[model samples]
Target: MMGLPFFRTPEIETPAEIEAASLRSDRFRLQRQVDWQRLDSIVTALENGRPRRISDEDLLDLPVLYRKTASGLAVARETSLDAATLAYLEALVQRAWFQVYGPRMGFTGWLRRFVGGGWSAAVRAIWLDICIALAVMAAGTLVGWLLVSREPDWFYALVPGGMAGGRTPGAGAAALRESLGTKPGSDGLSIFAASLFSNNTGVAIMAFALGFAFGVPTLLLLLYNMALLGAMLWVFADAGLGWEFAAWLSVHGTTELGAIMLAGAAGLHVGRTMAFPGDRSILAAMQAAGVRAAQVMAGCTIMLIVAGVLEGYVRQLVGDAAARAAIGTGMLLFWLGYFILSRPPRERET
Candidate 1:
């Protein structure tokens, strides 16, 4: 007992020690109080949408004040400042940092940029991939038509049972024609649209996602999808409803198929970069290609959504073949013009 004399634990802070800490914190705050307050005010004005209230001089001073406050926080952290001072500085530094270096634009601004030129720019950046994908798709369609023409059995292999939905190879003209028309009830149109959207989205995603496998899978996917289209076309053509089916499909197919091509191109772009990295490492090339491809894929998703709407509602409501063709043609032109004519801000300036 004598050997183990009572000793004060370092964990216990005495009242006088607490008071000294408080004084040190107060003195530290006083030294940097003005800069901290200035940063807080600027941040407050920005957060409250009162940027106009801030003066030009204060705006110019913002970064400097932010750096000073951040430095103060570091010092406080290192010196074991009072908890209250540390907490205040932490909050103030976080708010200041956001105002100083956070995102320059909101979602709406980003969307406007994307729609105006970002999407089109991304699409243009992968023009080579788009060309290759288009060729592959056309070849695939030809192959499907040739296979089904030679042997009706190939239709079952290309088109799924649910998709065929009574529009099989040997189906009568009346049945095939009826299949092209809208159903009697309108209640299920929403569900139908959603289902189509989900299905098309899945195909688009697969096409885009499979590019990581050196793009072979993506090419195959695109070919398979176009072959399905070819199979369907053959079915309708065999019954003399080819033009009718073409019109029906065009109402949505222009957009949907375009989206698929873009997705395929995105995948191919990734694959091509990986295969031929040039001076850069394969990983670096893939990263660069991925950014552009992702942008194109995003646009493809929007296109797929539009296609779903047109397929579900417009295709159903519009029975006239000419009108449907006109709509589809107009959409195709719109996309072409948008991608071709729409220039980025930098390009426009130049």
Candidate 2:
């Protein structure tokens, strides 16, 4: 009563049909019945948009089970069975077929999608938060710059000497100027730049990882990190090589600091979701915001690598203040243009 009735014959079964049906039914029920049932449930739920209820193990087994169901379906077609059994196998095969060979985005495809538009869309969505983060960093920089400029001793208090790499406020001008150029006999350029890059990466990681706690820690982190930058610059400038130091720093600062700022923005995004999760539950809002934040953070990480390489190779080769400024400024403008001005509009109308 349950299959292609137009092709079906009378209900009476021959002895051969009965024997074959018995063997096939027994084989399918024992070997594949449970998997088919599970597959049916998964396919049903997926079609309904409630896949979250599916367990990870079941999700993992979906394709495998789907393939197995297909094999069983092939077997079913070769064997005699009741109309009801044939109909059930046919339905299961169709569902499994959709899943096994359905449209899907593979890894390379996904990477292309992310690069093409995902990164830009994420950046645009959190532009306001990025502005706020930059403002905070600027405020902290100004405060630290002013503090060190007023009382040179504040540099020592604000920035660790180890991080200063002997570029203290009181260090001799000759000694300080030496830092403007690559060290005379140093193979430490790449190592040093990589170390600094790692340090910056750590700060960004901490800023993002700690953002779920209402973003207070993230705020403090941004303030402190930017303060260090300002204090370092002030110290170098006090030695009468402000422009030189600016040039040297700019070779990497635009990308490095920009990366940190984006991390701060990601942190703030999480914190805001925690504080004001509009209509959705806090967990739901956080989940959505986290995806956007991750996209921004990924781009930030790439920027940091670019910055580190420049610091190691490009900055090392160039020591003139003007040349350094030109390179650094050009890099900064490139980033601003790429992130803010270069991307195409989201959608086009024919």
Candidate 3:
């Protein structure tokens, strides 16, 4: 019983059967070979940066050819076509697909676009947040000035001892003036620049990162930092070094403070969007706002780097008060012009 199986074991394909399969595979390839070759040529031209070599008719035909070739790939996969034909079709379809729908520009082109107009547009988009943050910073500065003016103890409370660097409220005009002077050598300039850059970048990042809490933290952070500035301004102005102090501060402060303001504004933009999503859901609004805020923050980072260089090197090298003021004014003007005038033509139309 066990010896008598109901069905015979299936035999392997004969030589004739193997030949037949090969002929079928050949026929399949021959049917689609023309379309595949055309797609490959078009893709190769694009990849080689020879768009001019491709005819207008071929450009128009690209999507169609890609679709047809893609369909052939599907059929080959479903029917278990020969391995070589399968590989060729898969590769051809991929190339044709890229030609039909892919990023039109490279990284350099993207960077150019961003520097040329994209960043400024994003900043302009968040103008409301900027106005609010500016007002808060101003108020903070005034508060700091008043608090220290009313009680000298507030100066010690507002400014850290290391930052004070012996330029306290009681410090004489001579000591404060010397504090503003450039150090004798370049020994610590690099370290000073790196430290300033690190500190400023940290503040900027915190202002942005804390925006998720409805932007209150961002406002407070800006307020506290500006208050420190106001306290120091009082200390210097008290010592009759107000003009010199302003010049010293402005050489880097213009760019550095502007970056901080932008960072705060970016955070406010996100928080405000999430707090009041208007017609959109909170998630969607935050997503949209996050994109623009990110652009502004990216620009802020660049500004901070520039500020660090000015603070560390240029401020040290240039000692004249008027020269420092001029440099600061020039930087402010450049940023103003960049943000207001750098929109792309298309953006201007909209």
Candidate 4:
């Protein structure tokens, strides 16, 4: 058949004989499993100017084979050839390559499934917690602000102990502004990690702490915290310190405030369960509420860490007003899109 020892036998046939043999083989086939798309791809490769044309010498690099059930013509063992198969063999190799790897990883199909599943799942929990808690907190804070403005001293006393550096409201506001607008703080990462842990723990404690009030105290505490945020923000804005407040607060504010509200909501849930005790016993209701609240707060803690990072590092590092605005807006959009636009895995029918 050939000079090469590997060319075990010669396959001599006229074009008419080859066609007739192909027809006979096709008649008894279990299925027409021809990989024609791969042939098309092989053609495309040639059209694109492959470095070298396939030649008889190229057959040495490829494994030559014959199938009894298929046509008795020689075929390449390798699915993809290295610019060296004869035109006919090149066609065969391309078809095999396409059949093996081509159908599985379609880019368009992959992207659709990815957006439907992975990305959506990653952010959905955080989004749900944010939406539900934020709306409630906003309302509570507004009411608290109205209540506290009439009695300023009482409101001041409600703030928890251990503020950073004992800075006055004015001084703290300035520092916060500086912190937000300046480059990354020296201990920004540490601050973020510490604040997130502490803040989340604070919410958990708040939920536990308010238990003493038979739940009213917890509601009051949350309302008080919200009022303080609203009033302080009002003060900052009135002093023409809007950007600084937004920058300083939003950096960690998103996570911290979000966590706080979740905690407060947890407390409120406990209180409501006890207050109503609809069909279930008071103890059972409280237990159920606690478990759900724990889930929500746990998610909130994660949000705090992310918020703290942005607040402590990214927010501070980006000094330009426009940059701060853009980042803040992006975060807000992310929160909104994740929660509102993205559907949960549970909602999707399997």
- lDDT values for all models: 0.83, 0.79, 0.84, 0.51
lDDT of 1 by residue, 128-170 (tens): 9999999999998988988999999999998777666667788
Please give, for residues 161-258, the per-residue lDDT of candidate 2 as tens digits: 55677777788888777666676575423443455677788989998888888888988888887787789788778788788877878889888888
Least lDDT summed over 10 consecutive residues: which range in candidate 3? 1-10
In model 3, which regions exceed 4 Å deviation?
A: 1-21, 186-196, 347-350
Cα displacement (Å) at residue 45, model 2:
26
User: Which candidate should be chosen as best, given TM-score against the real structure?
Assistant: 1
Q: Output the better candidate (2/4) by lDDT.
A: 2
lDDT of 4 by residue, 240-346 (tens): 67566566556556556655766665555656667777999878877776666665555555666687677556765666766666677777677657645765345
Rank by lDDT (best first): 3, 1, 2, 4
**Considering TM-score, where higher is better, how would the candidates rank from best to worst?**
1, 3, 2, 4
Instruction: Give per-residue lDDT, candidate 1, residue 185.
Output: 66
The TM-score, computed over Cα atoms with residue i paired to residue i, of candidate 4 is 0.48
Clashes of 2: 0
RMSD, candidate 4, Å = 15.4
How many clashes (backbone N, Cα, C below 3 Å) per candidate? 0, 0, 0, 0
Off by over 4 Å in 1: 1-12, 55-57, 186-198, 347-350
